[model samples]
Target: MEIILWIGFYFLTFYAFLPALVSRIFGFRVFTKGRSDSGIALTFDDGPDPEYTPKMLDLLKRHGAKATFFVVGENAEKYPEIVARIHEEGHILGIHNYVHHMNWFMRPSTVKRQIDQTSDLIKRITGTRPLYYRPPWGILNVFDYANLGYLQIVLWTSLFGDWRKKIGPDKLYRRMKQKLKPGQVFLLHDCGSTFGADRDAPANTLSALTKILDDGKEKGYRFIGIDEMIAVTEQAKKKNKSRQAAKGSEARGQEERVAERKSSIGPIKKIVVSLWMLWEKLFHVLFKLRPVGDAHFFNYRVRRYSGPPLDLRNDRTLRSGDHIMEIHFENQMLFEMGMKSKTSLQLAIRIIREIEKTLPDLARELAVVPKGDQVKALYGVSMIHRGSEGLGFETFELPKGLFARLTNVYLRFLIRVIHPTGNQRVREHSDTLNPRMLIMERNTLLEWADESRPNRRPNRERPVESSL
Candidate 1:
């Protein structure tokens, strides 16, 4: 019996718990929230209740609000008119399985059947197949990740206990109102027939929802369907990328013109730049680096600090395994700037100016990311040590080891390849060019971000350095 229990434990761990952990913690293969500036998504699940859904729809329509309803196949099949009404009313229809049941207890094939039946039923009623699926209670089993490739798995950003009558209208309304800001996906229910749910719980939800819609509308919030919300977020991302690319092109064009006046990039330097950029691309893919807002010069990835404990300002100590945002310079941009500069000093000053311009943007972006507040520090390693103190970074000598030695070799090679007077610069600064760790604690970064003047240039007296 003990052996059998162990086997079951392992089975549940691999087949159910592991996948849920990955989806919940890492957000792998899931759309939890959006990035809209004013759009809010209201998603309802286990719904199409005869009593509540129509009322909710009426309230939403009166407020000119659109929502997404993840209707159960059984419930939707029973109330096809409600499902049709949802579609005709210009709202999104998504799947919530055939019956309200957790995916953890279902086999991969069973989960597929639950989804297919619901999708086909929705299409039969509404004449449109759902491209989105929200598993019961937003829980996923192992196969749900790859098996549901045809459907986008949606989770929620804000989940009020609206499925319980114990939480009254006032409390639910207050909770919903708190999440009224943009890019929020709210989880609500329009049915209470599922296990452990109060049969009339959606009554309170409907009651609270009216006030939420009114409040949100008054605040200039657009209550959109999940599909529209996702679309808007994607559009925003594409627009940001386009803007950044345009700025990068403008900078590159200006730098190229400057380079033409001084010395054109040699064929060897061009080859090196190409190879270096290719490696940077691969590294970004491997590490899943995200850009710091619209900033063109830096990208970062959250990582566990595996080094020795280091005490920082603000009573913070980053021990081994603490989370940190590992910052990386956009190498190609730096190389382009280097090509434009006649001297290393000029390149260094330009780099400092860029950091001063972009650090606040980075701080703002990080402040919005999930678990961003838990990050211990922003960390990087660089050979350039000057002006770090002025820019609010603490510099530490990298412990002598194989990692440090390899970093030293790689950075030196990068300098030689990217710098115009690479050989001469290396000869002159060899003694002071060792790599050092640069760290900015979370509080200090936020403080600096609050104080940053994006339009201002770097102080000429204290030029900052780049973490190349």
Candidate 2:
């Protein structure tokens, strides 16, 4: 029974003591200002003026509004009546520190005394204690011995620059209203920057106030006191903390699920890579077997190449990517072939042809390629013999059979000719050769003992399908 009684007493003591201790240490002003809704908090510093304060108060009253005033302690004592009017009119009174001293230069006790006197003076005049405090010149570090934060620090987002002598109502209004956003605080002065409150600064503030208040009211915004705004902001903070905790848990769960899925898929990627390599090599061999040109056709037109040499057969292998073959001969004959390959085989064939055409005598040495199903995606091809640079890899999704059309066009670009003496100047031989030019050219050295060949019909005019 005694233990239970002790625990209850402890709980009660902590509940009662913690907030006051914290509030006293951190200062109430740090936490207790303004709402975050579509409201503006207007705070005016250094005032309780008999001249401009009354005019400002009357303007606010006409507009049915209230503001916070951080008054100098001495000024409040001088115009106690004006302070009372402000209190009665429902504007919050705040301390701007007695003497507005640069407390950082003063001793600790002097700083305390400055706050004490202003606080006392404000309470004496208004009957209600001032809940807000503003540091002189928006500064706190210079006055280190003077501690503040009696209520929330009310910082303004908009300044009218009314303190400058040159500013007029039009300039002030444009400057202030341009940044008038929801949940902003605006700072102005009713007194002190200039003399007697009837100066340019105070006058400009008064002039700009009416339009600002009217515009805000029409936009469905209500001005909030600093304390109320702080209360709303705290409530929103608590709600956000709760929402973030829930989202964090959901994010954690999703991350775990994704990790598990990736673990399951590790092996499948390896298999696809293996198959693509094998198909690439097979096509590379086919490209080597295909003949390039025939010498018999040169009777009709000069054939630039006698076809890829049989000795270079073993030197050919598939490479990856797109390729272009440019054939240049000492005889001034030129051929250009563009072949795009999605597979290694197509790329190897085009490279081989390019090499053969450019350096027909050295085709065997240049045709060497690696054997295997391990070659990956190729992006480009280059041939040393022709100095031809190929571009736009196999990844460029051109239409099927486009490479075939390119090949035919390249072959036709170069004329066929038989230079028996291998000279640049050739003698005209014949005109018009049959389409069986490849057969005649290949069989030129073969001894055909059986002459039982069937009679050939006239050449058929079959249409070739469009490659692209």
Candidate 3:
């Protein structure tokens, strides 16, 4: 019996406690907080209370603030009018399970059913299914990661013990006030009827939240929904990445200028590169490109294509307005590599290795996006036309039009900017440096991910030159 009890303890630890610890400590497979400059996300749980929820809504409306409410399924079903009101008011709704129970105590299937039921209920009431979920108490089981891929699991950056009535409004306000900075996800309770919670605790929460909302407004903070907060965080990350890229380019340019003091065109080249980097920044901002996983070598943005139809290999044709993930090489990274390499061939080999390392990460990142599966192909135009077929890409000549001509000029300029010998290399290889479209269908990309193949050198028979 002693041995059996030990086995059960170990099993429970592995099955639940370990996973919960990983998620809480490292935020694995969970969105704990956001990165934004001017947005604050206020999220409430155990909500839709008959008395307190309406008051909270009224206070929020008066302050012109938006929030996210993770409502218990049972409570939401009972007071659906409150749920409807929440939707109508443009506040985000998230699932908080059917009851106030710990996820560690539930089976994987049971957790999935709870989420599905709650999501269906929300859809029926608000005509929109909720995409975000917060497990009760932010606990997780081992299977939660595998089972909940379709839903984004949210945690919080700040949690005050507002569910206890004795804390009162004054103390709660002070605690919440300390976390009033941008990009904070505040976890507060709006319904306090659960076990170990004071039933009237939410009354104090409401009172404290009213003051916090007014203070946040007066401080010029935008109280936004969690969805908007996530979007803003992504935009912030892109902006930071652009700035970092510009700094890197500047550093590289300075190093080159110092090394080649005899070259009178160095300062002029640096100015041109700075202007080019500014254009890249503007392009990223306009297109909203996202980095693939944590890899800075590649960024992509999904956009509707309005170009001419192109036939693909699998009896499929991509027509105008089809969604495609347009891929862009991180220009600074390429420029740095070129500055470090001795020749265009050496730079091309280094770029190939970097792509091999980053493609799998890009595949995994795309797999999680909501519209990722719907995208037709990964597409880009580059002067790196040679040896692309060896990397599972189909190459095509750009159509003769204004867009094609502009792309040709832009890519040729990029190659010169990133080449080790700059204009000398371009003059030597100008005939072969024209831009061409490189495309890999979604299915082929997924196959690469599924195989998880080891990186290999490109075919040596082909010219190993690329301006990626």
Please tell me which predicted candidate would have the highest TM-score against the true structure.
1
> Which stretches of candidate 2 lie above 4 Å from their native place?
1-35, 142-146, 149-151, 192-198, 251-468
**Candidate 3: lDDT of 284?**
71
Report the lDDT tens digits of candidate 1 across residue range 1-468. Answer: 999999999999999877876787558989987889889999999988999999989999998999999999999988999999999999999999999999998899999988988888988997889999999988899888778868999999878778889878887776677567798899999999899899999989988888887888788889999998889888989998888678877777885687684466678867877888878876876787766534458988888888888989888898998888888898878877776777777777787667767667666655544457678888998876777667777788887789999999888988887676887778888877789998988877776556555523223466454433
Every model's TM-score: 0.56, 0.46, 0.54
For this target, which candidate reaches the highest lDDT against the unseen true structure?
Answer: 1
Clashing pairs in 1: none
Q: What's the candidate order when arranged by decreasing lDDT?
A: 1, 3, 2
lDDT of each: 0.82, 0.48, 0.81
Tell me the deviation in Å of residue 286 in model 1.
5.7
Question: Which candidate, 1 or 3, has the higher TM-score?
Answer: 1
| TM-score between candidate 3 and the true structure | 0.54
TM-score pick, better of 1 and 2? 1
